[model samples]
Structure formats: structure tokens, C-alpha cells
Target: MSKVVVASFVLCLLLLHQLASVEADDQMDRTAEAKSDVSEQKIDCKAACAARCRLASRQNLCHRACGTCCARCNCVPPGTSGNRDVCRCYATMTTHGGRLKCP
Candidate 1:
């Protein structure tokens, strides 16, 4: 009877440990998701596009196009122009007339 009791106690402990491990893994996943959300939020499209369009000759057109591209791509390259490689989506977007949509 004592041996049976010990075996049952060990089984219970193993189950508890497994549950705790699963809970820990779930918590880790939630933490990673939250961090990603925060990082995504940190990308301010308005401010980034404003900075990107600062040097353009056509300020209104630049801002409009940059705003659209930034909203779609969630990123802007680090200059007034010609760094489209940094944001592939911005680089590749096309207008109906086959011209690049982004400034």
C-alpha cells in the first residue's frame, strides 16, 4: 500500500511539472507577442514620412505619396530620396500608369 501511495504521489508531481512547463511556455509566447505589438506601434508613419519628404521639390505630392507608402509598408527609408531598397514594399509599389508610387 505504501509503495502504491509513493507511485501515485510521483505521478502527481510529474503532471504538475508538465503543467507548469506548458504554462511557462504560454507566458513566453504572450510576452513575445506583446513586444512585437509595441515595436510595431513605435513606427510613426506620419513623422517618418514627413522627414522623408522634407527635401522634395513638390512637398505636397511628396507628403501624399510618402504617407500612402508609409501606411502600407510601415516603414520609410532614412533620407529625403532614393533609398527605396530599405523598404521593398515602398520600392515596388506602382501607379496605374506603371510609375513608382512612392517618392
Candidate 2:
């Protein structure tokens, strides 16, 4: 009788541990999904800013303004630029590899 009780207790503990692990995994999945959503939003905001810059005649002001717009919209600043409005705006939106490479 004692042996049976011990076995049952062990089984219950194992089940509890498994449940905890599953809960942890679910929490991690939720976190990852939230991060993905934020990234998508940032990308969308950047694209919109790029479009605005394009329409503003290649002025650095447009691109610089776009970066600020992105920040207000909850995204990391793309970077700074010195070209005309169009090029600067494009760089601000697409400059991903650390620093801006000017021609």
C-alpha cells in the first residue's frame, strides 16, 4: 500500500512539472507574437514615411521629418542623411547596415 502511494505521488509531481513547462512555452510564444506585431507596425510606418519623402522633391527635410514621424509612430530612427530630400529620405528609411554609405 505504501509503495503504491509513493508511485502515485511521483506521477502527480511529474504531471505538474509538465504542466508548468507547457505554460512557460505558451508565454514565450505570446511574447514572440507581440514582438512580431510591433516590427510589422514599424515597417509600415517607415514605408509611409518613405512615400512622403518621395513626394517632397528629394529634400533632406522630408526625410529628416520622416524619421521624426517614425519615432512618433513608435519605431527606431532609421538614421541621419545629407543628400537632397529624396535620397536622404530613402536613406533614412532603408539605412540598415549600421552607417549611411554616401556616393
Candidate 3:
């Protein structure tokens, strides 16, 4: 191939490689952000449960049980309603005669 044609081809290849690398990085960033979001949600749920546990006067077994169940179940924060929350699982378990119910 002529020198000019070879140089042009090399440039195109470099551009394509850069684009692919950028796309890969973007995907990785998105995955990391999603993971971070989940972690934050878990922390928020735990905090909320702990606060509620501290405030309740009854100290019934159900309070701790509900908190534990909420921690274990999948939950999204409120305001983002329509998204799944741990309370739903607890409610389902209660309705279905499962072990985790408020006393």
C-alpha cells in the first residue's frame, strides 16, 4: 500500500480502539455506580430500622424480628415508591402465615 493509505488506515484503527475503550470504561462506571447505589440503600434501611427499634417502647420480639426481616429482604427507599421494599416481603410473609409477624 502507498504510505498515505497505510497512515490513514492506522489512524482509523486507533480511533476505533479509542472508541471501544471509552465504551468499556463507561460500562464499568455505570456498574460501579449501581453497586454503590445498592450499598447506600442497604445502609439507609439499616439506619432507619435501628432508629425505629430504639424509639419503640414495647420492645416486643416482633420489633426486632421485623427489623431483622427487613434487613434480610430486598428493599428500596421510600419516595421511590412502586419500587420493591422490604416491608412488602414482611407483609407478604404475615399474610401467608409465615413466621415473621408483628406481635
Candidate 4:
């Protein structure tokens, strides 16, 4: 009765403690994975952006947007005025209003 209740509460607390510890370990692993991905995914954003934006209608805005997209995705399509298929992620990303975000 009372003893059983106390035992169950203690067991539940121990289980919760174990779950929290596992969650913390999982978070640490995910953080490490993210760091590794960032290092591995670094790209020559300046050159990529310049190439992509060279013939754009709005050079300033194109350079800015292309640089941003290249940095995030580590890729830019070749001869990039309209060949966004080379980098599908960059091509598909959209603004809050559903407009294409990349240059």
C-alpha cells in the first residue's frame, strides 16, 4: 500500500533520470555532428557567387543573395543565370512569401 507507492515513485524517478541522461548524450552527439558538417561543407562562396551573379539583371542584389545561398548550401549551379538545376536545394529554397530566395 504505502510502501508499494513509495517504491513505485522511486522507480519512476530513476527511470526519468536515466531518460534525461540519454537525451543529454543524444544532444551532445547531434552537436558534434553539426560541427563536423559545417567544417566539411565549407565552399568558395565568393567565387561561386561572383560566377553566378556575373550576368544577373541586378548585380548587387544577385551577388548578395548568391553569396548567402552558396554559403548555406556549399553549391552554385554552373553558368548560373537560369540553370538552378545544378543546385536543387538552392533553387528550391523560398522566402517567407513563397518567392524563390536564391539568386
Candidate with best lDDT: 1
The C-alpha TM-scores of every prediction are 0.68, 0.49, 0.46, 0.58
Tens-digit lDDT string for candidate 3 (1-103): 6999999999999999999999999999999999999766654544555554554566555356546656666442233222334457644445356553532
Report model 2's TM-score to 2 decimal places. 0.49
Model 4, residue 17: distance off in Å is 30
Clashes of each: 0, 6, 0, 0
Model 2: per-residue Cα lDDT over 22-95, one tens digit each: 99999999999999987666456556557555546655766675666456444433334333344444444434
The regions of model 1 sitting more than 4 angstroms off are 1-10, 13-17
C-alpha RMSD of candidate 2? 8.0
| Residue 23 lDDT in candidate 4 | 100
Local distance difference test values of all predictions, in order: 0.90, 0.60, 0.58, 0.88
lDDT of 1 by residue, 1-103 (tens): 9999999999999999999999999999999999998767747878998898888899898999989988888889888888888989999999999999998
* Candidate 4 lDDT over residue span 27-87, tens digit each: 9999999999887977888988888878888899998888888878888888857788888
Question: What TM-score does model 1 achieve against the real structure?
Answer: 0.68
Worst 10 residues of 2 by lDDT: 75-84
lDDT of 4: 0.88
Judged by TM-score relative to the true structure, which candidate is superior, 1 or 2?
1
Ranking by lDDT: 1, 4, 2, 3
